[model samples]
Target: MSLKYRDEREPIYTCDRVVHSETIQALEKDMQGVKISMQNRGLNVDVNKLSALIDGVRLDKDKIRDSLYENLHLKGKVNLNSARDIALILSSQLGVKLRKSRTGRYIANRRALTDFNNPVTQEISQYRNLERLLSTLKGLYTATDKKQGKVSCIYTDDCPSGRLYTRDYNLQGIPELGRTVIYADEGCTFILADYDSFELRIISALSHDKYFKDCWAKGLDMHKKAVSDMKGIPYELVTDKERKLGKMLGFGLSYGQEAAGLARNLRTSIHQAEKLIKAYKSNIPEIEAFKQETIEKARSTGFAETYFGRRRFLPDIISPNIVARKKSERQAVNTRIQGTAADIVKFSLVALHKAGFKIDTMLHDGILVTVPEGEVEDSIERIKVIMETELEGLKLIVSCKTGKWWSDCYAKPGRESSPK
Candidate 1:
């Protein structure tokens, strides 16, 4: 708990003991190189296709708006943009169960609607999704350079975690809708490689939880495996609904989700949520210990450090306010886990760019790069090798998919969205 370092040989995130100041500096420099490469080449997008997609989304949005009016039986009577109206309709009129804020008034935000199973709520979510999708992409058409047929974005270190954010068209937050507009050059293709179940693997790596590691070694779907373990059945027998609850259960606890939050996410009773969390923790007991130790360290140091020494200083870790202090505790856990995730991705990008790949943007856990049509097979292997980084005893897995368009992550043209 001492503030002084023991000659900087401490292993904070991973067992490799590589979280040093100089190592972090070198990686940041390499990330700059990759960013420059991305800016120089820009993103190749088909403006015409993007325009058509926007039209389609716009039409859908209009239909959803009308559908909302018809469903609520308040055609042209309520304002879609008004939270007050939506709250009244959902809470007072329809008597739908709604969550309230700390102030204890009925709310109509996304979190309030998370467990609302009404058709109107689903339509509302769809409408909002389309709205958000269009807002991010509609600006791209205007920002693109017509002569170059590409759009460039400025990267910044503005997020809490050290992940890079793209601006001036906000390429960093491209939603699923934006993927359909990606256009490659005539003789080139796009290669996308992402880490598989990256956060869970990182958790197992950090905690060295045996059962979790064993599951990963066998390449079992962790969600289904959890259900299998709980119900004493085979993995294949785990239903989709059970697997989904298992996913919510695992990740929910991993990121410090509480019983109430887990209940809301799973749409189950608080008792059931607690039972699931208890069962999950019984399976992987070490994760809780790791979280406690991580939070204690952050409390002692007043900051959280990622695997590579990226620090997020938390002034509220010791705050007098219980809510802020508890939130800071959660942030302490999340910053290290999620921050390490972002760092590994950047690490992969730095390695691949230095190995002479024409890198594009990073999509959370993956990278999209452009290579010659004939060099895809070779480049995929190279990217995977560089990306499947090694820790002390654990090696990461990288999945690659190539396509003519960014949305297309298929091996063959007619293939569905299945991984190869």
Candidate 2:
């Protein structure tokens, strides 16, 4: 059937913006500072080194020498004094001036003139090196099928919110899921375990962030073991397409995805996609009605409620921009569903743990619990009850399954390939 749609394609972005070093230098270089010379033509860097440089503004001389001696491929030797000169030059070019303190201590521009500095700028600079660090670690991967023995359930899907652009067109896909499967270069990545095991892996990846250092400190050792033991089996991380679909299915359902959006995300013309969305809405009248009611209620009352009294400000509903007004309407629709789902997961986890099951994996919509075979059914019953009691809208479609092996009992959207 013909579709009543204007544009169904995802927005494309130009990631290849040529950022000249000169421009960056213009913005960041500070002169009248401690001079650092880049005498070394070849420089070697790892995640640790890059992180330290960003965080401490200094690199360990012993660590650099050890890296050079230990790893031939990753290590490229450059004169240490030259490297310091280079750093000083780069620092000056970036507008980061250095000054001497009364105590003979050296400081950056922020410390010299004012103690206050832009947190966002500092954050961005740190992240720049951190991104490079992640890239370096990608090469260290070695794959095995040890995780396959665990054999539990497998779930695979995509992130709907991530947008990707090809040469001629723009498309939407789930990039985060794919990140795990392939190196940053988009190669295949695999873990030999079940869904729960894989879910924990994703959580570990999240802990890699410096701000999440607490999670890293507590979970890093355990996480590294999990990664190492899984046997790099070359599993595909959820692709941009699939992630986009999952987002389309998951988030769209919450925010009341209309025909046009549904079709676009589904990669079909609007006519086909909208029909499915309409059928879904029709099956859940309250959810659809809630969308309109929320607009009115929020406009009049100035707030929206969550399952557990979680409130999100909705002042944007009265925005002057019609686009923003529409966007707020969508936010109200999705937030109600997603927020309630989050609460249900939390409630289920608490009840399951109280009931003596070891909860292993937690998603926005689902929870994974490890229990003895004798108590599997009982655990499932408790989880369902807690989720139902704590959540609203249509009842959840919970399918309880058990496994003797991890790979045999993973929980994923699809049965074939597990979602990363």
Candidate 3:
């Protein structure tokens, strides 16, 4: 009957929070000292400056070549171990300990299902826990409902506090490209990353013109309209329900789904679903361009680069098998664009954190950041700038809305509850 204890019936796990930030900072300071010692040995390297340079640099071709080969003296090959060493060195110079990878029972269980086959990768992380690590982690992760102790309808919020509860309509879930057996699940697990990116891209593209209409009419404003227009069976809609659906639909289309799954879920015909998809895409050519740009860039560059020096190889775009090739193309497309979106969010998080924004929840494209009332507006502007400027070439239009209640948070207006 109560929702606060949603996870109470399930196993709970906590981790050593110290390893992530605090340890990194300590290591950084120690590394600075180490640099001085190494300089006494004649290395004379400016570790801090070097680390800042690496973290601040984008992982483009020239940067990668120069950093890995020229600076680090690794020619023609590299490994994760080396990457970590470089990161560690940089962290020391910056007077911040890069978070040490931790392994333990918790880490094992978390990666168990996804990486069951890799015993080496599945090894429990080996990071030392400092004071009160478990307790701090537990305090932060306790499950509590949005409404303290009331039987309330599930609604969306912009900055929801407490736990989240979704009513199960028992709708048949559609199968996504990679994952099999899809149905509505608790939390945001089944949400597709591609669909989320596509929806945002569509909104971003359409919002470019004023009093101007295009194909799907699915700009940010139109998204508000479409979300507001949703109808459900027993369908007495509540405030947060529409926003929740909007988020779902947004994530759905982001993954490149056609009409089958959506129509089935909506109890609508596939034809109608196709119509909606086409209309949405037509209205937002910019979204289409985003997709095209990512694919083209990935194919040309041979790797997907992030704002920082992180790089993911994109070797499959030129696969030989038709199915494999097409799949890789989609992967390449989604990874670059979606990955860039991730970079923006991460950049925003680091910047906001530096500016004192306490980030509570991080969804794929958006974030749930909580700051003192006096600092919310400034934090918002800082985040917007971070997201926009972090990615070098992409000119993104990021907006936010601020409200007092759990429902008042706004990345884009019209949503009362935070993203589910």
Candidate 4:
């Protein structure tokens, strides 16, 4: 018998061409528009409000430090801002036990702080949050394009996902608070559309998981359904908390989270985490098998390929070190899911751009398009159609929202509606 020969690199090259051609042009054009609009609507930070907030945080930190010193009857003025100093004070003066975190931040980690009610720990966490907020503000100030009056972010397409990464300013990683400062230009509105459970949908289609497919077909909330089935509760009776846990397990386990890591994330015991994993796997055993097969293939071939043929070299999979091998295995499994989702989004962007829509930003699984206020509805419908279109036989559920502000696009109630 003669074996058929096929060049695996052919499909990858084809995808590369698509990504590097019109898609790159579309992304660059849209990014330029976004940058100009942002510059015109330069983030208006209320300096007085920010100053007041910072001053209040400093005062609160001082009060907490003074209270601790008075109550504990400790020594000379200790630097509460210093984690090491706080740990020393707590351990030596107050006889409070302290544990070093994975990053060596003593008692500063939420996981290491056993007692949430501890005044000292609470104060430290609050101070840190405020400090982080201040640091973020400083970063934003530095990132702001002074001459252009806008924040200019660098976009890179070098990742295996083929997704555009906003570098330097990291607009993609901005926190909710940071996003509030961003506004849409006058006469233009933000139209945001994101794939719902994009990776899980891809996994379902790839694995042919009956349960997942049926849920997607029926438009049921998979997170709630999974929680209900796993916990033996009625779907309607499943609490938000339970559904959240189910979502965490459903997505986390699929991405190769170990029981211990899952437990740590859930703040539960490893046994409980293992049980949750087992229940989740039992519901979609095919996905588990698929993931294992993916890992094995990467281990054997020293690389993994996404559904769309994008290849990720995994040389560490063959490493003698167990930790490196395990990390590589996780990356191999995760890359397929993440990279495929990225490709799907990129494809949608290219399609939409070709259709004459103005894309403002390309998120990991979402696209934010700037449209005239009068054309918001039309734009939303068109975006939904483009985003939900089948890619490699996998269809996605796309949700869209329209607002005058970027934050409002996601924050407004009842703003999100799926276009059937």
Candidate 5:
């Protein structure tokens, strides 16, 4: 089918004009303020503690290695870091039965090792995790600006998502535990306004999925509602685990996950994963149809567009290579969902700026604003209004919180907080 491609210049030009001028200026100023605040209230890293942890991890690793060497009667020291070495030692030398992993990784790195509760494999995994943590800490330590007494992250506006990216220190890449080291400027509390289930809500609005819309309308937990609908059970009767599984499946659908991938992620049987996917599709047939239509459209047109008409050219969608074509198909669907979410976030940032909210940071689906203690309540309300209003034709439930530090802003239902 010869498909007509929409003039890509229009959407690109529109996005450039909208985001390049005042939006960039506002973001620049926001980033400057954030950098200064971060410097002034420099993040505290306990080097001693991190070093101790590293030492402990090394000791544990050594103990495991010594035990393994003795048990297997190995001739020389084996490199545990080498997946090949580990596989040879376990499979060939030690006569440990190893299953073939689909990922083509060593048996020790496979999911089956965790399922079988292999102590040796678990120890190796623990060692790797600790080594990763140590590397991250080292990076942070080296990146710390001694003159400014803070880690200054360079921001870029080049991301297609219209969201900011941090270079050098990579502030956005910091793990939750790492985030605890950062503190807000004294007397100036942190206020986080996160759009709950932001992209899923956008997808629901876009597809006009009845189950999703009905759940949102009734102020029900969307994940729980999905489980309830899928299982034909009362929402209250759905367990937390079931709700989590439902939530995973719901979000995974947006990423074009197949049954095998879902099964791997949820650590369930392929049959169970298929059943979950079936349930979700049965509950929201429209969304499934929409996704299929999107892939077909992209396959025909060599491109797809987001809700606001942002085009993503997908020539690979029609590629002869199965892997490349499948990837492009997934990207086509994801671009519509994720790209729209990005547009909404960008819109929210611009709106929030015009409304005079001090945007500390713009996370993937959340905005961290700094508000004075007295103005926290008012700021939260205004932020909610701006974010919700900017995304016209959609009803989203935004959650807000106040905290003395960034880590303190644990998301809750309403505007209630114990700002420490």
Candidate 6:
């Protein structure tokens, strides 16, 4: 093994390539406080519950592994952790038509196989998910502070997405099923506040789209409305499945998803994906126009700006190479709402932190707070009010829930409690 260390004694100088913001100085420093609060607050988890969760996931993984072996005769034959081994099995044994890269090597990545219509693919995906869940649960237990029974997660803001990312025991990446064991502290309840359809609202706000704003104000289903308007069908005729397709087109095309990627995810042909994109664009041209405008401005300016005035300089936006330039254009479209959503979440975190709240964790567009049982109602009201404030002229809608555990907040809050 070899070790390389930074030369601490070397002279340091600012290269001056960074984009400095004059208005966001305090905001930048306060974002650090948000991270500090998360680290210091630690995490409250039920050790016994977490152990049970780990056991359940391991059991499920074992069952899936056994099924996969029985189906494929792979018992003691192949390493399940090795994608290449499974990919070989998929290509050679199962006769699945695996995709090849430009170099003619078989692509065995999850993205390549996740949408494949094979039972083995489903089994493998399930096994992998359960395996990861088991590992994450074990990591949480290992990272738990023995004396305090709190899991410590490390967060950093060096994310290209401009959001705080959790490392080590990555709480932000935890699935809903895995979060059930993360409970509120004794005598405390968890308050969850998230922007309703956050990225969609950001796109609408940025584009000054009156239709989406009206939908928000009237409490109408945005997806259903889009389908109704685009397909010339009654809103009531939009089935759950069709509305789901609408959601896919609405969100995906807004973020500049190409037809190939959409087709892969939708398990459909590229032509159908293109038609969906066309339908979405034809009916809701405001968002489409906004996306194009964002890319055009960034292509000319060599940078993208979020709603909160954060700038991400894209040197590739002006590149002479077509591939790099198009990729940069897609990134510019994504940066508009995603970057704004990140900033909005950070702003909410700072506001909540200043209002004397202990932030449990921050997800992409949500914040969790631990409040005393007596203060639950008041906390929810204050948090919703704080989080629902206007952002760049569009009203930010906040949805609040109180729960005993993190996962419970996903459903309607129904946790009963007594005062401490």
TM-score of each: 0.86, 0.38, 0.38, 0.82, 0.80, 0.88
In model 1, which regions exceed 4 Å deviation? 1-20, 66-78, 88-100, 103-106, 110-125, 410-420
lDDT of 1 by residue, 211-282 (tens): 878887897888999889987898898999888888888777657899889887766799988888888888
lDDT of 2 by residue, 238-342 (tens): 345443443354345545567776764555788777655554344334444556776777677555543333345567788899978777776654444444344
TM-score of 3: 0.38
Instruction: For model 3, give the 10-residue run with minimal summed lDDT.
Output: 170-179
Least lDDT summed over 10 consecutive residues: which range in candidate 5? 1-10
Compare the candidates by TM-score and give the number of the best one. 6
Clashes per candidate, residues 3 or more apart or on different chains? 0, 58, 31, 1, 0, 0
Candidate number with the higher lDDT (4 or 5):
4
* Residue 189, candidate 4: alpha-carbon lDDT: 77
Clashing pairs in 6: none
Candidate 5, residues 1-420, lDDT tens digits: the string is 011123335323433433223333343445455444433433434444445545665576677667767766777767766777777867776477666559976565646456657676676666566566656766776776545445656666565434566677777777654555555665677787888888777777677777777777788998888888888899899999998988898789777899999999888899998988987888888788888888998888787766656567777898999999998989888877887776667667666766666666667788787778888788878888777642335576688877765667863555433233
- After superposing candidate 2 on the true structure, give the runs of residues whose Cα lies further than 4 Å from its correct spot: 1-251, 266-286, 373-378, 381-397, 404-407, 411-420
Model 1 worst lDDT run, 10 consecutive residues: 1-10
Comparison by TM-score, 2 against 3, better one: 2
The C-alpha local distance difference test score for the whole of candidate 2 amounts to 0.37
lDDT for 282 in candidate 5 is: 89
- Please list the residue runs of candidate 3 whose C-alpha ends up more than 4 Å from where it truly belongs after superposition: 1-220, 224-253, 269-272, 296-311, 320-323, 356-361, 368-420
On the 0 to 100 scale, the lDDT of residue 137 in model 2 is: 30
Q: How accurate is candidate 6 locally (lDDT)?
A: 0.77
Model 6 spans > 4 angstroms off: 1-17, 90-94, 108-118, 412-420
Worst 10 residues of 4 by lDDT: 1-10
**lDDT against the true structure, each candidate:** 0.77, 0.37, 0.38, 0.69, 0.68, 0.77
Tally clashes: model 6: 0
